[model samples]
Target: MKSTFLILSSKRYNYYFRRFSFDFQNKVIKTKNLFLFLTLLVLSVSVNAQQNQVQQDSTKTEKLDEVLVKAVRVDADSPITHSNVSKEQLAKRNLGQDIPILLNYLPSVVTTSDAGAGIGYTGIRVRGTDATRVNVTINGIPYNDPESQGTFWVNLGDFASSTESLQLQRGVGTSTNGSGAFGASLNLLTDAFSENASAEISNSFGSYNTRKHTIKLSTGLLNNHFEISGRFSKIDSDGYIDRAFTDLKSYFLQGIYKDENTLIKALTFGNYERTYQAWFGLTAEELQENRRQNPYTYENETDNYWQDHYQLHWNERLNSNWSTNLGLNYTKGKGYFEQYKPEESAADFANLIEEDSDVIVRRWLDNNFYVINANVVYKKNTLEVISGISYNTYSGDHFGEVIWGSDLAPNTNIRDRYYEGDATKNDFSVFSKATFKLLEKVTGFVDIQGRFVEYKTNGVNSDLVDFVTDANFNFFNPKVGFTYKPSSSNNYYLSYARANREPNRDDFKAGVTENETLNDIELGWRFYKNKVSVNTNLYYMFYQNQLVLTGELDDVGSPIRATSGKSYRLGLEIDANIQFSKVFNTSTNVALSSNKNQDFNATINGEVVDLGNTNISFSPNLVIGNSLNFNPLENLQVSFLSKYVGEQYMGNIDNEASKLERYFLNDLNINYEIKPNGIFKSIVLSGLVNNIFNKEYVSNGYFGSFDYDDTSSPTGTTTGYYSGYYPQATTNFLVGATLKF
Candidate 1:
């Protein structure tokens, strides 16, 4: 009966294949071939390795209590380049900054902030890939908005406080849930259960009138079965830029039940944030005149947003060889950025005015996301397998409203919305992966995933343009690799992966764009002995239809991007850590890459001109970061951090005028702990001095072009270029204190 069912399913799929277009049919065939090849390889290896006795020690397996992130996380032995940040490391930098700022020192990472500081809206790029291309997850749940494909750290202010650990995998990582990992993937696991009750209070004050206060309490492991923990935080910052202040509040709560073979957890977390608008950076002239000037002079210009998340997770260890995990998650998000416009057209305002007049308007976004994820794992002897599936739905509404206007009409209401649109999306995917020990020192790995995505939009945009769009996409991603361990202290790995990503809402609005594809190959070597460790990796990624910056800004100040014909990124990454003594250590990481647009062309004077392999925008050729730690006393520690970024272009055109200069920055950090005999169990004090050299630099910028005519000159036509920059703050300091009992 099973054979008959399989035959029927194959026939049905064949019929569907015949009905599809030629290109789609080819894609389906390619996916099938990839699956078949992987299956054959796995089977061949298993047949030869099954004769050897397998190691079935339960101590070698991961515990079920930590299964929340197992669905999307990769093991250390996996053939990937990754970095891990623990809670203790985060606490040292969690004074009053966002998560992106905290992760700025990782390998192949770059971060920027709009408020001249890290307290407000911030952005992160990995391997020159923008936030939109980076896949993010929290407890195995997708964190990026389905439409924008971007993670807004501002909506989760001080989230680092609740994160127990996080992993950053660079370059087409293992298949995971939600959007594909084109450049990188980040997964965060919240605080785990504690065995002892605890209470804590934290406070910090810094430059620009920045301050943060937090309170936390935990009822750890009640009756050895249940536990509850919660935290509340409030942060305020007067940014370095004029009128760029921030006001934010956030909270987190968790309840857990645990036993020998079962674990269930419930979590609720959210944040409310408001900040003055500072989206527009400074032009060259403006930067030289007044570096802190803000274009928006209106006192009430601000962006207000709040987000809430609820998640439930269950993990059951059916037996020593089998374990399963299930997760249900929902997120509610709403926000609006308000602005005051001068000389606005009556037609543009939905005919609210008969002539041009000043008006106050708001662009709002309200969205809800629901997701279900499940994974089952089987481990026996030298073979392990995992099968995972996930489904997600997102509904979002975008609208524009006239809050205040200089009109005389009495019937006009402030609450009336002029433009509104709704967008809905559904994403579903299934994946299977396996690992087997082929030899005493060699392990093989394979992963395959199939995903289906659909997006629909209805209504008009703020520009009154019809955005009735519907798109459907199917993707198959496959990864295979092997790890060879020459000894306990040395290992080498080689891997190749394929990844595909669908266009986001913003990309759709720009124009019709094809899906993006990447073929990445990686080779790495690691060596560890005594107090010294070193890791180096070489990667080459070939891309098709990759989206790149065009040096243009849309109506709402968002950067406009266009798809390129072909591109490639080749790089080498090295990271090392050395312990000089029992109390002194140093860690350094460096990345050097060559990124280019292959056979690039542009239309000039109605003629297609070959640019010939120009540099890709925003991808610096070299990035270096280093840190030194010292323990002068038993309870006091001091550290120094430094970073350097090479010059990079702001647009794919790669004109000399559109380049950002190289920059070097340094920071100093110090922390001290005290254990008193009084009521307080421990007290910690910390301080951070940023930009210790007071160096002035621009971390991000854009370029624009304009056509000009000069009748008096020899040439009657001229193309002019302009550049803008987002400047960083000078030397600043932050002081913090924490009390625990």
Candidate 2:
């Protein structure tokens, strides 16, 4: 067996070449198409043979049909479809990395990390939608919080260690839970129950004191029925930004029962994280000073937090052609970050009062989230369907205290408020979805989901005192989609989906409670061949009442109330994977997108002007990725990856308060493996070099309202106005080794 890897590292090598020799002229050069075909054919044959051999080696009670169990959105091998990243691939490169980083090489995916490294604050935008818009599932269960609609990957520290397989669905076709697949959906499955009890340990280190250590153990299959598996991991990093030190840890445990026609799984996991406030952006002058600011600065007063999750799943095949699955999921998360602010008559800093303590000026929150979700699925040839419901609940509280800080004062001056007051609330809702077949090789699916959301705050500053009463909402969301398979190797699809989101607790605390919604219409084409695959999609979106983050807020970070009259995104996405030959492989992802806030009208920084055509905040105009893999020797593999991001705004008002400059990033890696028979399958050594050129770049920032004058052509405010950019790491090098069992 041969391990596959392509290295595209760049170096200065001057090789003198004379006029073409007769031997060179006689040498054959293959076309790109031929190379792609051969590579696909070989890969398919190799993988197919491996599966057959593995299956043949295992003995079963009956000669049952070979069934492929998929841990993904759709469970079929439909062309123009899904790509599964295996555990081996995940571990060999960028271990302890976030899920988004694991999918960087796949089609139509653009992943960015706030830490300038893959281990923390990583995000993936399939096509053009942000992380919040993507539906994520772990072991076939939804993972995003239904209320806040945000996926905090940090909650699962070192989860990659426990994962055995993952799939990224680029377009909507299959039936699943909760929200429809607007941009893409990710599915991950942890390692299976082991046959024998054994424990293993692994550790790795990369840029920014980023390191991970994990241990895994599983009881071998017991009594032809039950088995258990568990894992623990700890990850710490002095984040790319100064002061942002991350100390995170998590654990996973599972009990499983499997047989010829039945499989039941019970699983639970949780994580605790404490990091200096890195969410806060920086100003221009700061960016110029080394571009990398420490997170534990004295002026930055932040809090710490931790969260946990639990789930149960059961699957059975009632008959040969009728298999069924049912799942129940629950999650609980609580944590907070603190800040310093001035005292006021509104009793704002009430929650921070420490018992038996003097008054001090400061603010922070103690937030918590809970969710209960269930789903069922049944599949058949030529027709596949799924239906399920979810009940989600969320609650959190905000408190203030007279800590050692003056309100609106520079240098974190000391101040203590006279009184204490706080606020809190809860929200709940339910939803359902299903899909069916239409015609030959064509399938259509429709989903209808609804949620009843409500929240409240107690104490002197509770109940959204400034806004209307009872800030509650009930919404109905519907989506329709179609997938056409023109041929066994070709597929096309079209889909439309819309979503409505209620304001989070913070949105209301600042006296701004508005419904922010998004609607998307999409169309795309897919192609698959023996060795190469491609997917391209076009999208148009509509934003109604989007919560535009106001640079200036009333004592809180919530955006001021201002409904976007009209805003849309139009773009094209193209992703392709090709292997030029047995020793070379390449892939590229490119997004050409344009987002504009049409007719944006509001009293932005006290000015009423038509702020239309302004670039959507945080939406980069262009994102691109390219990679090349090459193997110069049988034991050595080298690769290079390049990423580019076009300039973008930190605010919708197009002001100087916040904006990020265009930047490009590059990465390189090299690995060599030695296959030793019997005792060890392979001995591998690897190294990764990040920010090859040490280019300075900012991941994201917040805008300041004071600097902008209504579409006054907001210049890139490098100082004071913009909170701060997550300064990317400078060029760094790492090396590690692996021994297979």
Candidate 3:
């Protein structure tokens, strides 16, 4: 069955590629092999599964009858809250940027691109909480690693290709099944199975030689009872910063079987990213001398990563009042960045640089991670609830090779092979939530969760060492909220939630150099129609043995940190959306916040420093975002948006000298939907001008450890401090076409 499937898939791809000139590109050639494999799998599944059960169950389909986002007990929604950017909306807002950068127009949101233009290594902050605090999930499976709980957007380049819609839930939200939601929860729904047989070819190009090409295949009306769909895309770009480049590829596939009361689904996808290590940020002086110089920079280092995910789900209904959601997911990740180190001859450095070795050492990140989660949902006349549990484990080897060290004919030859520490981690969690309506206008909800985690590492050495964190434990956290709807268009809600978060790897590893904390808060809101909304949230986030990144900068330019007496965050956020008519729309958001260390005394470079009443590092006083849309003609529309950030300090001295200056930035987008949704229909468009004014502003960055000529030296020289920016990209443009058949 599989062999026959492969042959059929090959023939189809050959036919498809024959039409594209890029089919001959070097990268495209190598990539075609992988797609060939995917095509075979899809073909095999399509040919062998003669029944619709593999495509979808007739009963599980969205009837196109009821509104789901509104009926659900999710907090991301308010009568005034915004959710779901239509396919058209996403196309019109095309900034040729990463998901985070593209969504920067949202209220109280800020995005940073380590790769400069959203093409690689980008992140989004919601209401002050960074990506580390956000809960990201794709099709209900948690996207965050169980151990570090971090989401690397770069790993899934152009993932938006398969995504149909996404919702960002700010702050505490509806009871979710995975990691705690501290900052926000992003739930993504990938493209649903198409009902017909059609294919689309899309291509777009912009600044930095950045471009993306995509091919999608739909088993058009395949037997009318079954559908198979898949997407293959490749994206590459020359980063704004010197030496920065991105080469990435990704895939998405799904098989669905539907019936009036049952639904079964099989989904698989993955991505690979090859990039340069631009983490070593430049200094103001360095930025001037050579804005593109990479100090940690070396030769042949490719930050390459690949991930593959698989899931199976079955939805069954036993009766009118009871149903169950059964699912299983598995993810595997592999790849690493290779780096070169200069040779050294000291006795202690002897191991780092072997005798007669080459001029550089290569390092690799053999990281493989996976997770499994299962959920069961039950519903009654006025109550609904779901309980679930999950288990995850992963292992990674940070190994290296002595390609050369000290022996080469060069200024500083270093190359040798060595085993760096290899680490393995495991994690699990159990959670549940219930929602009940006691009266026609009243509803209540509660969720409880607990988790267990452990880890260990081997292969220790002189400067680098091994560590262990093997343990099993549980933390019980609960939340409660109420919603009242006097009419279909308006609703009032009050929610009180208490959540706890264990320090992930970034916190512990960057410890003594960074900060971490926990939060507790209450929220209130009112929604007036989907176009207008109001909210007031009072949160007193408390920290236990807080690790606050001080506003102080080390000689090396990394955020310095210390154990604080206590740290607290009190803040408020407000957002609104208004539609003057079908042709005009406006949205805005504001955040007022204050974060500080209550008390503490610390020593830096052997000097006693007072941290009492000092502001925490990277904490901003205010953030604002505004967007406006106008329709100048029936076939054209334009949008303008601006993001304003307040001054932010980098250290804890309450120092005014080292603060990042506030800046206002804007972007523009315009699109014309030609022949939209018609026979031989299509859309042709162009997007322009991101960071329209080209305002130069620095976002948050860090200072590294000070290097002393001698441990006893009074003045230690600071190596170049590394930093990142919410760099406003130079004005850019993109032109693309989408066709439907």
Candidate 4:
């Protein structure tokens, strides 16, 4: 295995599970349910006895100390519009689905799955902004690819099982690592150490031949100083669309050393995924005829990817008023997407081949990411200050090979290579943040950051042309805010922030591009009275040279975007939670927004037409989600979840023919837990029925126009539009169980 470091600390658990392997060419499958059952049963008996014999260690009662991640996380008094999902909240919905699906109900969030059932290739849009504009980090380490500026969730299968907490900050809330947060930022923290030794087994089965199995174990503190924990999971699912299936496996391991004044930690986690492609959605007419149909018909048309992460962290408390943290991180990622192209390609293949032939090709990407991050903090009676810096680099190679072909030269090898290219990016940033108490009930905040980005790429393009592009960008982001708290239960805040984002890899390929800028303003209030809690925020974001979707798709089905002159998004979001009674509780969120592109122009039929004040593509005007929970029995719970999305257009032109209709969806969930004497500590059973109403809906699509009348004159020529739709599944069910000891 190739990695940044080799340090295996859990000798006791090393014999239990072997290290992971990425080889899948000759994959084998074997069942060991019987052995798992008996092993867990025996461990249950021993764990119970161990639990009863262990005494309460004084280390467990020591004062809670802050972790190194606080340097990157948003503070309670940061005057930012954000939300937090605790471990308890995540556990309720962590059954084999992507993390985006679990956060679908959050304000201004929209989720879509390529497999149409939330198992393979999922996507998320927040406040009308796509995932590429969102910055994501895990335990203060940047997770977004520097070149693509995108996060591939499939590479981290079943990550929700290891996540202890998640926080989302909207509208470029604060300064952070990696790419700029043009729309929002999300941070995830893995599970904290357990004070007692424990073991868990979980299994799930659902509609469409879907199943998931997981095992987790922990070793309590040894010598009151060190602890170890690990988890392994496997998930398989036959998707709603034809041939859209997923088989995934992942693992997580951590070793920690903690004391009253210092903490050190090392971690390793990653996943391997093999899934059939479902990127080619159906046409609108085909969607009506057969909503479950998939256009891709080739066997072994799949995507294979694997990612591994390594991190070393150290934190020290110099004194009551000073603290510092240092972290080193590395990630190794490799993947390929295979495709089958039909015959008649000799002349079109840049004359690389002598004769027409049908061929199977694979595009591969192998990359390495390295980073060093450090931060220092100072706090006093009425003021706090933090200073941080980070440097990270990404190097990747892209290549393609012809694996099989109908016609070949006598000595031609199937592994013949073709197009090859590589890209490198270096990013560095420094930031300072401060908070001061202006009065007893009023506080002020300020943050400033300076960043430098360098991008370089050179290689042979698909057209057999030698291409090279080198770019450099410098950006300065500033933020200021104020918060007023008249009482402990009521609070009000207002903030303004400015951010800049550089062009990504795809953007460079299309043409020469410039950096984009955003100016955002946010105002929010929070109130809590008795059994009710409410939060509301109003935001206005203005953009310059923004990249907006133009309803066109590339060869691989990714949306095509063009630089718009100007754009803006204004929205209001509200979230509320209420406990109606001892047995009933409810939570709801609503988002209303107006997104527009000003003075957009396009060339059609040799004529330039100015489309004045058109709606931004794929940005809906309204979105609502609600959840109702009931606990009728001592250990039984039920929940109803609902979502509604308003009509929206698929293009910046806002043509009525390219509109996507509104949709309403509902889901039902139930969970029951059992507590018995002796060996077993707890047993949990859970189930989910999604889209209970069987509503037929299209969540995503594309539209474009072409000159139908090929007349030389611009006056008489006409244009026609075409569209493709991605329809979602009607109804499905998933049932699961968990045993802990």
**Clash count list over all predictions:** 0, 44, 50, 0
* Model 1 bad stretches (over 4 Å): 1-52, 55-59, 408-411, 604-607, 708-717
What TM-score, over all chains together, does every model reach? 0.93, 0.77, 0.81, 0.90
Query: At residue 579, what lDDT does model 1 achieve?
Result: 97
Ranking by TM-score: 1, 4, 3, 2
Query: What global local distance difference test value does model 2 have?
Result: 0.59
- Candidate 1 lDDT, tens digit per residue, 507-580? 99878557999999999998998999998999999999998878777777677788888999999999999999
TM-score quality measure for candidate 4: 0.90
- What does candidate 2's lDDT look like per residue over 1-741, in tens digits? 211210110010001011111111223223343334323333433342343242223322211111112323443333224566888777757456677776676655666665566655667766545565577877656676554455778777878777877777654433344444445677777776676766656667877787877777778789988899888888888767666677788899989888878778788998887766555545577777666664345554554556676776667666643445556666665555556433343334333333333333434345454444433333333333333434444444444444453233323223333333433333332222333445556666545444445555455343224422256665556566778887977878777776666765455655557776667777877778887978777877777766554443344322343445567777887878887888999888887888778877645444466766787667777888888889889888898978888777767767655667888888887888889876655667778887899886766555654443344445432122445566667787666665544
Candidate 4, residues 1-741: lDDT per residue as tens digits?
101111121221223222211111222212253233223323432233233332432212112234555655676656889889987787777788889888988888888888888997888888988888889988888999898798888888888888888889989888989999988999888878777888989999998888989999889788888899999999999998877999999999999888777777788999999999998888877887888888888889999999999988887777775677788999999999999888746654444445768878888899999999887765544455667777888999988777877886566677676788888888877666666665568877767676778888899765556668788887878788989999988989999999999988878888947999999999999988899999999999999999877877877767777898799999999999999998999999999999999998877665798988999988899999999999999898899999998898888887887899999999998999999896879998899999999998888888999876656565667777899887788899999999989
Task: Report the Cα lDDT for candidate 3.
Answer: 0.61
Q: Which ten residues in a row have the lowest lDDT in candidate 2?
A: 8-17
Best by TM-score: 1
Candidate 3's error at 56, in angstroms? 31
Q: What TM-score does structure 3 among the candidates reach?
A: 0.81
Better of 3 and 4 by lDDT: 4
Ranking by lDDT: 1, 4, 3, 2
Report how far off residue 634 is in candidate 1 (Å). Answer: 2.6
Residue 340, candidate 2: alpha-carbon lDDT: 44
* Predicted structure 1, TM vs. truth: 0.93
User: Alpha carbon lDDT of residue 450, candidate 2?
Assistant: 47
Q: What lDDT is reached at residue 306 by model 3?
A: 81
